[model samples]
Target chain A: MVSAGAGQAVDEGADSDPVIRVRGLENRFGSDIVHHRLDLDVRRGEILGVVGGSGTGKSVLMRSILGLLRPTGGRIEVFGQHLRDADDVREIMSHRAGVLFQDGALFSSLTVLENVELPLKTHRQDISTQLRRDLARSKIQLSGLPDSSSAKMPSDLSGGMRKRVALARALILEPELLFLDEPTAGLDPIGAAEFDGLLHALHRALGFTVFLITHDLDTLYAICDRVAVIAERKILAAATLRDIEDLDHEWIREYFHGPRARAVRDQTSPPG
Target chain B: MSDPAQMTEGRKDDNEADLVWERGTEGLLLATGDWVLDNVELLSDRVDALAGLASGLDASGISRLDASGALLLERLFHRTGQGPTAAGLRQQWRTLFEAVDFACDDTHEPAPASEAPWRQILERMGRSTVEVVHSTHELLGFLGITVHRLLRTVVQPRRLRLTSTVYHMERTGLDAVPLLILLSSLVGAVVAFLGATVLRNFGAELFVIDLVTFAFVREFGALLTAILLAGRTASAFCAQIGMMKLREEIDAIRTLGLDEIEVLVLPRLIALLITLPLLAFVATISGLFGGLIVSVVSLDINLVMFLDRVEQTVTLKHYLVGMIKAPMFAAVIALIGCLEGLRVSGTAQSLGEHTTLAVVRSLTMVIVLNALAAVYFMELGW
Candidate 1:
């Protein structure tokens, strides 16, 4: 896997063409500001990792980015297009920016192949049934599973395998931007690390932009080129992990300098 | 040490100051800068999001839970809290909370248990218990909102046109036939046998054909078939969709822009519609065949004589009325199953609860609809 910041490019166009720019974004469920005035810039082809404390609203920020949550008071510009209207959301989704939900969100009645085919067939109007099935077949293979998995329902797969299948579904339209929400939340450290490696491999291979909302520092350091911490209804820093370390907020520092952070630091740190 | 009027005046002044202070920052932000009211000032915004999610949502229309609180908290702490003064308390409290470190309402910091008064602790516990019940009732209100939404979807002038008769025929009609045939045949045989034993005393066993056909068409076949489908298929639909909803798969579909009822419920409704008429057909034939067997063995009436008597006694009209009642029974079953499935939320227990309710409601609706169809058809005459 590539080291953090190793994936940096000299391309200024992507930086200027920020795929999503959130300003003063806030979310609430009745009376709670889940995130308060969160501002962030997710550039095209940039793997921006969102990290935070348990209740800091990492997923909420992702929701706001997807226009799932109407940011209480702010702006979200997606692909230089503000997601202020229904049309913007439809436009962005049609561009094949996929979101892999934390629970895998595989429809139970549908077989694994059908789940992967769903997004493709549901969105497209002209693709024939045979073509859809063919695309679904390729997606099953792209997900790194045996052809036998095509007919099998999601209940038959293990958690880790289920995640890979979800990852495959996200890639079915060959998304330009992909959102992986807690891709490795409940996996064992080894499983998480393996998932981390798989994501890095895919990111490097495809060069597709990935916005990951996760708590795993190993994932943030091992794979993500930049980190965005969503808290206080704002993103603390939409910069590299090192830049976030320099941010020095209690929640951020306590996270990176905390026991979990220290462990990743020692492992990634150069020997004296 | 304080004058009472002076203390009261100071407190009122502080309340006004607090209100003023809040208005300057947090209150202003909360009032307008909030998510839904900001630039998204239209009711169409949520509908717009649902449209976005319609392409994204699974068949159940539930949305994914936002699961990133800790990361949000980390950012909150990092962005805004360092001063140590009366002025900083607001920022500190705001920063700590914006970080999601603690709930604004949770005042129970770990004061020593021995220092705490027992009466206060009991009173707090009692208050919390009441709050739990209050929330539970509010949860039902949320469910009512969901039900209202479902009714709105169903009551539209065009109604959705979800059920395809051909698709329904395959799933419901063919699969349900054998069981209905078996059940009706046994009931028919029992009725004929009971008739034969009594009719032997008078040597007038010819009326058994009339008894079996009339009873099967009027009462037994319609209700029995309804109960069977209600138990077997309707409950299964509720459980299946409910589980997908609980898994957030339905939300995933909605976010993806597919209509849930169109994808999940329509085909099943069609299947029931197709199946019910076919099942009624089988029930009538099997019941007649069973009575024919009883006639040959017990009443010394041959199959030919029994058929002739049935033709004379029970015409095409009775069977026609029975067959026509099928689609209404199917609609009632489908409506109940879909409604109960849509009611599902939260957990596995909720799925089980909805499934049981689907069965009960389907059975009730089936019986009521069958009775109504029978009455209306009879009112019109052959």
Candidate 2:
């Protein structure tokens, strides 16, 4: 029941107020403007998949909302409070959110368990060391890593395993919101699918809001409750896969109707 | 109140995370408050007190719970010798608890035991000795490869990369000229000052010219230039090639049927060989000029007399003695840098370590070779 040209506007029509809100967002480096007056909302407890062509400022947008990059001009609200570019507000936001950067970004020196335990130690110093280790171990187990991998350094692990370690570290604090930047960009197809499945399971079980940036159509189809298409310096459309697939837009039409997209669609959808 | 975010914030109050129970009859253990990451210290403290309680956990009184909290609850269950039941928990809390419980294997792997200190020291010393021997062998092998490649290029002139050689020559030679001149001139002036001071006591101040010219020509010029290159160019070569190897660029050249030695090492080596001797010559001239200025200004030695003195005493044999060591020093420095770079193994740390080793080894070899050359020249009575 995919209606043609159904998702034309960039507005979100969810009943509940969103967990993250961006309004009049503008990002500029020198004379080159990456984003201008970009407005979007990330609803509570939904995997909002963000898709864009390379250098379309998908990462810049994520950074701005997460307070890593201060937008040139914009209002960003997380958990119903305006972000003021202050350290305290950023600290509070950091506690509530976990980010999985592309390439994992695990500290090369620290072991997998130490890397995961670090956040708990930093945020909650009053928690005993034993409890911290146990929590880190649980997070590692939830990340689908064998307990043996816990003592190994990040440099010794494969790229996939490193990503899992990063995920475990991200989930250790049990954040209310999660941000993933190109989480499946470099994995093999099977590995990417398995990661997607793991993410889906965790999302369901934890019930936390997810803001995922990805170019993988399979990942978008597999886990995203809604897809937000960023193009032309703003969010072109933000809607479910079926709704966005029928949008009368150039990038969206090309992206969702491409040969690869067709294959992903066939694999994800049932027979007509 | 309907907002989960607001509810979570509200549950952050310290009093919300409390555990209450009757010691007898009911076995009803009530867990209250926010059981999240922020309240973990308090929750864990409360949980530790009831560590081995074999009571039916009625977590219905719990206001909030997250993964960290659920993991803490699972720890309590493990201690109590019972699996957590969903009987008295909310549906969402039950799911979270199950997710954590399914993954939480609380049995820790004991730390590996340490060896005796003496045994450890012995093992380390043996390992280092083996490493030194292995490194020397590898260095000899790399030298053989480089020599073979150089001979091949000598036979087939077209195989030499002229552009790369010139580029490196400009970098390692031309760019280094000003610093070399500055340091050599300063050293020459200092030597003249000291010599003049000592000779004036004997009323033989004219001998300062001989001292300055002889020191610069036979020893200081070549030694100083080589030492400077050891610091500057050798480290540069090591870091450049180490980064290339780290990024697999060296491997890419090999896959393309190109010899990395020919493509990467030969140019740097040839450039240093050509430029080092030239730099030594420049350093010699600058050093003499420094001596000339000091002698004229301080020692009252006329320019003509100073030149005449240098011409009379310092023979062509001394210049040859100094110039001969430049190419030798250049080869050692270039080879050590390239060999250390080629040995880098897949980490930024390794690159840093190899770069440092390149500089230290090249500096040591330069000084050692210079000392041997000095002894030989003295024995031959040059």
Candidate 3:
């Protein structure tokens, strides 16, 4: 079943156009289906958090939107360009969006600075080597990584620093949209909060849309403008935190009303 | 959206948030605009240059600040010891500045750029030597553990994975037959041709039969087959086990209370032991058949005469000696492959490196063992 009214409700609230629109999306691997008639929208310049239980296809949805995976059936549009006919999705998406993979996915052979410089070198082939290095260095610094980390290999850095390097690489091209897959999955609470704060600050300063796939409740509360809960092979709800919390879905109630969720909410709330 | 570079260029202009310097009695410097992450880079060079000249820092003119911008200001203040000037900031800005100051207190200093080339080479040499010793020690330890596990499985026959052993036999042995036969046949013909040419010059052309029979039965048959298997099956084992390790499947097996050596290594080891000798026998037969064809066609030796010569020169002892080396070669290859696979670390690069290492190591060990067997059989007057 498809929910057109719910999708339209999202469209009406945003002043700007939706950066990503998925309608009747279906993903299947042989006989096993991951998504069915999934309808969702991510508005421009907003941090939209996608949350779901394990194997619920949150990642599949993200991959479909990024054009990494071809959906079995759907009309998926990014920046109003239909992805179905694109011969090279990677090349097209590389100009408009950057993704931070869960494991950082930094090239093991390259230093952190070189990893950050890769996108710039790939896209801006005509730029001088010196200017490329300068831009990459600024991005690394903006990610809150120290100057010393520039020459170190990804394997040599801590998990948190590696994630920062990945973030730096993702931001190097200055894309209009950024995709992050479990950005804070491995970091400790303090480190995750700091990463969340960095993402929030970067979003405000750069005004780019973020499609963040995460299981971290604190991230949704701290940085997300809206939250989309995926269950039963489709989007169960897509709205702000308060609205998602009030939804009647069983999984949604369990997720938002769980003890851990309440604890994070209490901890993040301002004192009276 | 049309051109990403143009979008970045437009954003760059907006992010060049200006820095204002006021000539005052106190030589105070004022910064304005959103001195945040995006705009902070524009001020770094100016801040560093002015840090030495300015008397003190003033953030009163700053409209906004974040961690990135505050870190720069913190560095400027640290360089000039102008901490007292931070009091002029709003509460939020002051808090952020203080936080950055505390967070970056132990900031890592970049390593010095210059090092002597000779010293660097020496350091690398020393490191490599240590790594070689460490890896050798690990390899020996792995061998000992594998042997012990194998013995344990021998004592408890139920632990041996019979189905896995059969599967590996089909992969490493059965699948290798055609290539082994083809290679041995070609080599056998070449050897016969060379021997016939050389022996004919000395009026000993008939002795070509001895050369073909002795070489194939004693060394060429087992050596070629083993070398082929080392390159083919050993590398496959390394890659398979290495990928399993990378994916943590080996760890999963361990967590399930299974002995890794018994489950992973023993099947491959037993399969190779059983199949290598059989493959070597087939190669010996195929090689002799090739020599038979050459003798019949080139030398005009009849089938009866060829069989009589082979029967007389190629004894059971020579065949036994060659077949004996087959199991040893198989053991070396399988052990090396499994060892290298288990030694694989995190990356795909590491898995590739280990796979190559397995083939090289197995081939070297097989050749060395074959040489040692040759010397032993010669000394014993076989």
Question: After TM-score superposition, what is the CA distance of residue B175 in candidate 1 from its true location, in Å?
Answer: 38
Q: Output candidate 2 Cα RMSD.
A: 5.0
The superposed Cα distance between candidate 1 and the true structure at residue A66, in angstroms, equals: 1.3
**Local accuracy by lDDT, each model:** 0.65, 0.86, 0.82
Model 3 DockQ class: incorrect
Q: Which residue runs of candidate 1 sit more than 4 Å off their true CA positions?
A: A1-14, A128-131, A270-272, B1-382
TM-score of each: 0.44, 0.90, 0.77
The predicted structure with the larger DockQ, 1 or 2, is: 2
**lDDT for position B114 in model 3:** 48
Maximum-DockQ candidate: 2
Q: What DockQ results do all the predictions give, each relative to the true complex?
A: 0.03, 0.66, 0.22
Q: Rank the candidates by TM-score, best first.
A: 2, 3, 1
Per-residue alpha-carbon lDDT of candidate 3 for residues B284-378, written as tens digits (9 for 90 to 100)? 88898888889899898899998999899977898888889998898889999998999899878889999999999899989999999999999
Minimum summed lDDT over a 10-residue window in model 1 chain B is located at: B29-38
**Poorest 10 consecutive residues of model 2 chain A by lDDT?**
A1-10
